[model samples]
Target: MLWWRQDDDERETDDEVEVRGRSVLVLISHYFPLLEVLDLSYPLHCYHGAVELSHLKKLRKVNFSGHSDINDKSLLHLFKSCKVLEEAIMLHCFDITFDGIAKALRERPTLRSLSFSKTNGPVKVRYESAYTTSHFISSLSLKCLASLDLLSSNISDELLSSIATERLPLTRLVLQYCIGIVQVLGICCNIRHLNLSKCSMVKLEMNFEVPKLEVLNLSYTNVDDEALYMISKSCCGLLKLSLENCNDFTKKGVNHVVENCTQLRKISLDGCHKVHANIVSSMVSSRPSLRQITAPPTRTGAFSARKVKYFLRQGCLVC
Candidate 1:
């Protein structure tokens, strides 16, 4: 049996390419005994027969995103099948539950990355009355977890807080379109990259520490000047910031961040109707380190074609 593959082939792109039927899945396990990665990410997938890859022992990563048939039992079976599974992405797998995830965590303590972003529906706790909800969620103590994406997943603040308490050294976090979460940055202090776009329920209040943070996305959220100020104060090391379509903040908030985050290299403000052309231009002029500015909406006057070309020539891009 192949313990590990040296490189990835074009056909098996981390298991991304689709397979038509259950027989194919079983055939893969039988022929390619050492299949380390499998990605079956698709859209609006109709239910199919289940063929658990239980015979495999070296499977490292798998993507079950957009599969409706892989429910709680199937998720546990998949994780248990892989001996050294490092990453598992089950986005839009509506049938998965917190209980399933809790059991799955026990089988993969070395998992480095996990995403349960269920866009189809919310993941719930099965046998709700029997299991302690907090205990079930707190079981997400993956010893090596680093990157987590819960975009559009209806997870409560308690579950998020549990991760923070575990103090897992998470470096990247994405919760875009997750309406249930209220406070993001507080729980993810160690995260270097964070995406909170379209999370209207978020409220940024009080000062916190996330000094290691480098990238942040607040596009289409309810972020205002006060929140921006707090972010500027907390994450001084931020390099790339996106505030696309965030109408609450004006030039004042933008300038505050620009002046504070000296290391900021890229700022994207596309769809922002309130920000004027001059503000973006001023950002370019003031910050020598600034390399790119995604200018505000065209209605607010995006940089002219000539001006864009001129700026690009000078090592800075304005568009």
Candidate 2:
């Protein structure tokens, strides 16, 4: 995979040739077969031209993350050229629409994985209505997809349902900030890492069987103590858990974790306010196999006269 960054110099170049004096035509004329992945990232809102990329018949994976200028029209152009393309990650490129994505995926049958996470931008006249709800729903056509990361991308319910019932070959899926994902009643059969942080739903309420999941991050979500209890009863293979900022969890949730998920190696509770320092200390010392634990800072209480004297004796040290 080769990662390319677009710059203003690329845009200022003469129309006769691209910035590098090499277009997709030149690439196709030379290195055609060995190319598997091509990434064009960074320098936001860049017009990285991909209209000539149609020549690479063997191109599979393409990443356009962090490119704000390349919108639905550019994506359509790229997809029209690369027929064999599989995975495409377009994080922060908010100029995509349902019609464009659906048309492209429908035309390209070999596409597998499609990710659009954290694709947000400032208010602009040209790219105002780029990311539509329909565009997310259009992502349901890829049946061969194995992984998807739509974290913080404002996904919809129709999209999640498509993944659950579309007979997908998905293995690794992330739906972070997909506020509509209330129940995995039908999904989560083969997911490996399922992250639903900052989602809208208060309760997890998963009824489907996902025996293969290894990592589950539900931090900043609406899951309460009862929901955590249910997850502790299920999801035996969960290795890493993030329950930070979940206001509903109390000591009950902590106790549930201690009893279940004996193989958990890492846990993050940075913003969980209900958890006390004593419980956190116990978990840190008791869990022999625990590798990492992230918690928020603590404040000291009113000091006694003896404590004040001790502080005076042990002055602060500077490096």
* Tens digits of per-residue lDDT for model 2, 156-176: 555566666566777777776
Query: Where does model 1 exceed 4 Å of error?
Result: 1-20, 43-51, 120-133, 298-302
Model 1's alpha-carbon lDDT is 0.74
Q: Write the per-residue lDDT of candidate 1 for residues 1-319, one digit (tens) a residue.
A: 2321223333443233344455556776788878788776663333453345777678888877778768877777777778798988888776777677889788878888888765643333123322333455577667688888877766566767777788787898888777666666667567899888877578865476789899999888878888888888888898999999889988888998898888999999887777776786678777878898888876544567877776776668887
Predictions in order: lDDT: 0.74, 0.64
Give the per-residue Cα lDDT of candidate 2 at 7: 51
TM-score for each predicted model, relative to the true structure: 0.86, 0.76
Model 2, residue 135: what's the lDDT? 51
Predictions: Cα RMSD each: 5.9, 6.8
Off by over 4 Å in 2: 6-33, 121-141, 284-288, 300-319
